[model samples]
Target: MRRGDEFAAAIRRGNRAGRPTLVAHLQVREDVAEPPLVGFVVSRAVGGAVVRNRVKRRLRHLMRDRLHRLPRGSLLVVRANPPAASARSEHLAAELDVALDRLLRRRGPDHQARTDGRV
Candidate 1:
């Protein structure tokens, strides 16, 4: 998820959804045979280093709570919008919930029919 190619692949090939605070890209890989991978993108356009890192931290915390819901071998990239730099954690969490719900619900049975525990 840290690699540029990983990020690019997810962004280019995955399903995408956006909210006021953030945008999410998700790519499900049936061949990975690994757990879900998640990455964050907090650009300078969102804020300076301090703000960006804070936003990343908040996103990490938020995603951690829902990581278990993703299908195994999925790749998810979360990109913070400028609004995320100053938004409250509660607001960020709400936006993230909606984003995850939208993305996960759209993954389809082909992606969700694995033996793994996924929704």
Candidate 2:
């Protein structure tokens, strides 16, 4: 999560879900022993420095409480869209939930197996 290579790897290998305000990439790794690692990508395309930071902060706060809901060792990267700079926190959170749900559903059997402690 701290390295650009990690972000690139996740974006390259993970499932993706897109919203008007955000895009999410998710990958499941069996090797991690700690909690899920989450990263935010807010490029200048999203806004200026201040706006990007604000969007990143909002995304981080929204993702914090929801981290435990992801499978252990998962890697998640959330990239903010231009509209995200003006989106409200609640709206962002809702979009995040929807995006994550879509991504997880796409890996239905694997997700179910993990939750059932079978994977």
Best by lDDT: 1
lDDT of 1 by residue, 1-119 (tens): 78999899999999999998899999888777688889999999998999999999999999888888787888899999999998999999999989887887797766555524353
lDDT of each: 0.88, 0.84
- Which residues of candidate 1, in runs, are more than 4 Å off? 109-119
Deviation from native of the Cα of residue 6 in model 2, angstroms: 1.3
RMSD of each: 2.1, 2.3
Q: What is the TM-score of each candidate against the true structure?
A: 0.91, 0.89
**Candidate 2: 10-residue stretch with minimal lDDT:** 110-119
Which regions of candidate 2 fall more than 4 Å away from where they truly are?
A: 113-119
lDDT (tens digit, per residue) of candidate 2 on 1-119: 78887788779999999999999999877776566788999999998899999898889989887876677777899999999998988899999999988877877774655632123
Q: If candidate 1 were superposed on the true structure by all CA atoms, what would the RMSD be?
A: 2.1
TM-score of 1: 0.91
Considering only N, C-alpha and C atoms within 3 Å, which residue pairs clash in candidate 2? Answer: none
